[model samples]
Target chain A: MSGNPVERLGRGTTDLVVDLGGLARFAGRVVVAGSGRPWRLRRLLDEVFGIGVLSISIIGLSGLVVGLVLGLQGYNTLVRFGAENSLGAVVGLTLIRELGPVLTALLVAGRAGSAIAAEIGSMVVTEQLDGLRMMSVDPEDFVVAPKAMAMVISMPLLSALFITLGLFGGMVVAVGIVGGDAGIYLTSLESSVEFREDVLGSLVKALVFGVLVALIATWRGYTAEPNAAGVSAATTSTVVASSVSVLIFDFFITALWRV
Target chain B: MNVSPLRDLLVGCFVLAGLLSLAYLSVTLGGLSYRGPGGLQIHATFDEVGGLKPRAPVVIGGVKVGQIKSIQLDGDLRPRAVLDVDPAVGIPVDSSASILTSGVLGDQYIGIELGAEEDVLKGGDEIQYTQSAVILERLIGKVVQNLGADSE
Candidate 1:
């Protein structure tokens, strides 16, 4: 605590590099150890249910609300330029290309990511991870891997649900509430959105976000200081780290895709 | 924890539904329809196609009739666009084709103007009257040149 400022800075940089290296090792172990035997189908299913099914209401509701808001705002702005009919295009493109994956990742990070960190952190505090190590059982496989796999599998599905519900919500606001022609709205949405650029791009983004969220959550939890306060801190770190990484990665991915 | 078959079933169904809906949305909303009615191809040549690309909508009187199938350079090095118009849509032989920008800063599409002719165009027919894209920069340059001349 009494070190020179430059020394402190240098120490911090070394700590960060070491942390990143350890994380990469942990992730590698999860991938390798998670693939092998006693294929835990039951555990994977439970993780999927916990991660995917439970988050549906929040994801769907937010998607619908976001879509509705987009429709309202897009209509108001487009009408001035006599391009009101293109509201569908605006809403569809926004949801599929950017909002769908990004928002779903952020929400899932808040919900599932924190839960993962907390659960694993509590287990660590209880010495369950140490017990597995003592028994020569790989904790990465038994715990982290299943959850990571579940998150990977569930993310794209959730993103699709978000986009689907969002489109319906946009339609409700645009056609039902805003007095826009339903036919035109549908047509414009169909004509403007592309399968590869928008839909696949979103799914790819979701996949990347899912991996980041799960890995960050598990990593923080696995490395927690053996205490209740440590578990809580890890959970908070999961949320903050996942959210920031999602946004930063999103910018890079979007820049790469240019969509 | 007890493994419930019902829960597994429900999870499977949910994932399946989500995937199916995604596929449906991508195909329908993305305009990747494959089982639609048959269409006929018509060719039109232009000096400059600008940013117009294949798959851009081909509209008639503000209604979409088909899409641009392909664009290739002709003998004179002009851009020739092949449009795949729906068979149901009958374009007159004397009709004109022009590249139009959707909005101020939007994508470009092909616009077909109907003509009063008894004979309707058949497949493989050429649209003789075609207008190329209007380059915004060139238009602004011309306007600026005119303004400068007036000031002098």
Candidate 2:
């Protein structure tokens, strides 16, 4: 009442609203950041660290299993109708459209998204965020920006890894058990799938999910009012938000666009 | 000072090599042949193509080399499926083309059975052998009956 509309110091009703405000401000800020900053540094880290290094094993194993099962299941079913060759069409479409993005998002959200929430949440409880604010820095620009940048930049690449690995995985199934040629599987995947629109459509969806993920985790974490419980809440919110947002976006995009 | 940076570098390189090689192996293995690439062009006539789409995989011996190029009816109204075969595969003219399901409740694709004929089929040639899709529910019912009988 005496000084400002709402106290900014510790945690208050105003701070909770500020947390919401910070999230609201992110849309415009991110666009500006995207256009002006271009995120090259973040992209490099995301590629090397977030996607290329950290994600390979999980994506590889997941893709392998998915490929094997698809091949076996597809072959068995086709044997009855004697339409086994059409296996390419089934595997290709499913890998590109459905399993690719959904599986990757879920896996990565479990892996990376949660980690991000916990790390940032830890910072908030430790007062590193408040320290930055005291030094005349916007914690949003300092803490939230870099990691959010990393997530947004890397998601499409991660999604690509998920999808391509899935294809490879499906092929293993195709070759080892289903008894299909490997070269033929790649060809079917390449030709049946239109690259620019269809594959790109999935990648674009991943990018959107990435951005949503970064925002949700950063918003939830960066504003937690310096407490152990707050950190936990932030962590839970990050996972739920990222997973829900990925699914909802997937459905809407699948319905609305040809991609 | 205890351990040289060169030693650390060696370890890093070793790790990197292992990961990259695995990734490469998966790529090469997964790069194996995909079906529906070559001469299986479609010259079929269907009352309704249903969900049948062009460039769909046409499989033979569980390999897909060509696709459904088009579907249209003939003068006598027979469902004519024109196939394109890889010149290398040497599909005999007597081979039969059947529309088969890929999975239990999956999409339909053309299946080819090699015919024991000397002469081979040409680009525009149609295979006389054909089998259509089985109604899924009926097939499941058959399975249930088979299972029940086996139990008895």
True contacts kept of each: 0.63, 0.00
Estimate the TM-score of every prediction.
0.81, 0.59
Predicted chain A of candidate 1: TM-score: 0.98
Query: Candidate 1, clashing residue pairs?
Result: none
TM-score of chain B of each: 0.83, 0.56
Candidate with the greatest lDDT versus the true structure:
1
lDDT string, candidate 2, B1-152, tens digits = 14445544543453464345334323332322322455444354443334555445687888776666556567887555555545577777777766776555455777778899999776566566566656667779999999999999
lDDT of 2 by residue, A1-259 (tens): 3456445343577667886787888756755654554455433343236433576678768866786678678778977987666666677677667777778777777787777788778998898877878998665555566677767655666666666666667777777766788766765565556444556676677777877877787777766657889888888888898899889888998888866
> In candidate 1, how many Å is residue A206 off?
0.9
Query: Model 1: per-residue lDDT, tens digit, A1-259?
Result: 5699999999999999999999999999999988888899888999999999888889999999999999999999999989888888999999999999999999999999999999999999999998999999888999999999999888889999998888889999888988988888887898788777787788889999999999999999999999999999999999999999999999999998875
Worst 10 residues of 2 chain B by lDDT: B25-34
